[model samples]
Target: MRQQLASMLREARHAAGMTIDQVAAHLLCSPAKISRMETGRRPASQRDVRDLCDHYSVDTEKREQMMALAQDGRRRSWWDEYELPRGYSNLIGMEAAASSMRDFKSSTINGLLQTEEYAREVISSYFLPANPALIDQLVAVRMERQRAVLRRDPLPDMQFVLDEAALRRVVGGPVVMEEQLGRLLAITSELPSATIQVLSLRRGAHAAMDTTFTVLDFPPGTPLKPVVHVEDVFGDMKLERQEDVDNARQVFQRAADAALSPGESRELLEEIRAQYEREQPPER
Candidate 1:
């Protein structure tokens, strides 16, 4: 929401043919503050937005739209209640507004598609040094994010491409993995907007071997541009520069092309789930 507002303000300023310095002077603020507002680093107050709109001479309808966006931006999301890790809040904010998403995971299932148990195990295992309470909160946050795909009014189009190794690896033991795979199969069968593809080991040495990233696309008429989010052991980074977004898109397309067809992917997932089920201890 903040990004959308910021993009609109930036575009309006550009259309007005004014430099950051000129706007700052008119608003009696430092250029740095205007820059931060335009880049979404700082929230724009209602007065600030009004002042900008007045300066930009934006059309009445567009001005109202930007003001409404600013108002919406001030409201906190459900994720805001939790103390998210550094860099995660921004990712969640973007995800919440995205109309579609493309995820490529080399290590495990994408968070949006993860089952609750799978997410809990992954969080607990990865953040071993963190408090148990914090891990649980993180798990809840991830589970809540699934709503983006599940919501009916405006369901998000999602594409997930997983490396064969991610599916084959026994995460959280056989029982957990079995359930996770089952969840994946259910999601594929139930959600027409969701597509899951697997890149086989046979087609080795593909792009994106070094990272797991997601690309988010917003709806038409939104000033917000596509963003590429990359997560690693250190932290998460949101890439917004045109070149960076373009490169990420190309990389994801290449990886998708190398992956099996959706039907084939489902077949493979079923096979792997069977393998995990076989490895599980018999129930009493």
Candidate 2:
């Protein structure tokens, strides 16, 4: 597979009438980098694929395939052997390729929505034995996944419905929780493609009460089926069956309906943030 990709890169480069040195100069990288990408020694980055496609004047279809191949290379990550925990790599891959995503978390803040401090606290609490380097790597990976929320065209439309209690639970203490809530509001306000809804405790229990899950929607003409990721401590359940997927979709819809709207959710966060502030005594 790598060889085929390498051959494609070389073919595209040759067709453009551009020398390796020129391409390397355009990319602002070493000649060896281009050589390795063409030889399959290193997987192509999305930027590399885009630049080459433009230089080669490839059609949309061919360009999309090459870029998708580059993305797929990252999906089969080698991070598993490092004991990075189960299901995380799968989550990253799903987030990377999903055209739309809906998440309902009844417990702590979802990793995708967490601030670095909140994430660090959560990781440390769960992986008590992990060293600083591993913790830092895990946090970095989580932040990288969050970038999906900001990507341009072909970016996923993200909707998150969090239980209101989750907002006030103080996952990493009042300071971290406050920062997280503020970050959530700021992100949603800035990203028109994203939505954050809060499922208030007063609304009573709903379909997403017992468990947390995510539904990932794919772009049109995608080869694989749409999947639902039901997360648990042991491992996650990847549901691809039509019936199961439908059921999860229905659950998410109901939860969204019960949750506060984007505007109201922001107001809710502001209120919580203020309340936490009031409860915190001023430093001497």
Candidate 3:
């Protein structure tokens, strides 16, 4: 709801032909505050919403809606339990609400497909020299998201395209990678909505090679807008414009087309898992 409100408020401001400074002046707040509020970076207060609504001469019905949105922003969510970076929290929140999603991961297994052991290694490495407790919390959050999004009924129209390098990478060592690969193989049968494809090395240099991204689609008739999410060194970015979503979708289609079919992906996963199995030392 916070995101929805943010979009609505931003659109309303444009419709009213007011600048951020203008709204900030009316709300008696900083321009940065108004900017953040419109971008979902800062939560808008009741007074902020009411003052802005009145300044724009908004209709009573619309004012009520914006007020309700401000209040809705305060409501607790499942991801709120864990203290997480705002971007990641928002990503998970959006993921939960999405009715369909496309995930294109280049370096590691998609979070939804990671095993607990694999996740631990990935998290531990990302936040190196960090607290074990924080690692546990982060891992716990991922596991919960997996169950909530993937291990349930009425699953999202999910499509995951894993680069061949991701499959071959020895993340968390041989055992963990093997288990993670096994999970990928099992997921196709476990969840009918999910389709896993492998972007083969044979297809060298695809459209999404430069970066890893995801496009999440919200259900129709919802205020929530579909967003194209990109994760880079700087952090994650959420692109909600229609053109951005369209471009991301086009890139995904090319990558998907270049990828191995579901059955072929399973075969490749099996081959990799077997290699990892062989690499395991002799039992005591």
The estimated TM-scores of all candidates read 0.90, 0.71, 0.92
Candidate 1 regions with alpha-carbon error over 4 angstroms: 13-36, 39-41
Give the per-residue Cα lDDT of candidate 1 at 271: 96
Give the 10-residue window scoring lowest on summed lDDT in candidate 3.
146-155
Candidates in order have lDDT scores of 0.87, 0.79, 0.86
Candidate 1 lands at a TM-score of 0.90
lDDT (10s digit) by residue, model 2, range 82-155: 45543565566567667888899997778877899998988787675768997888887777667654554655
Model 2 segments more than 4 A misplaced:
1-83, 152-154
Pairs in steric clash, model 1: none
Give residue 256's lDDT in candidate 1 (0 to 100): 97
* Order of the predicted models by lDDT, top scorer first: 1, 3, 2
For 173-196, candidate 3 gives per-residue lDDT tens digits of 888888888888889888889999
* Candidate 1 local lDDT, 140-246, one digit each (tens): 88878777447746778989999999988888889999999999999998889899999998898999777899999999878788989998878889888889999
Please give the RMSD to the true structure for each candidate, in Å: 2.3, 10.9, 2.0
Q: Is candidate 2 or candidate 3 better by TM-score?
A: 3
Where's the lowest-lDDT run of ten residues in candidate 2? 77-86
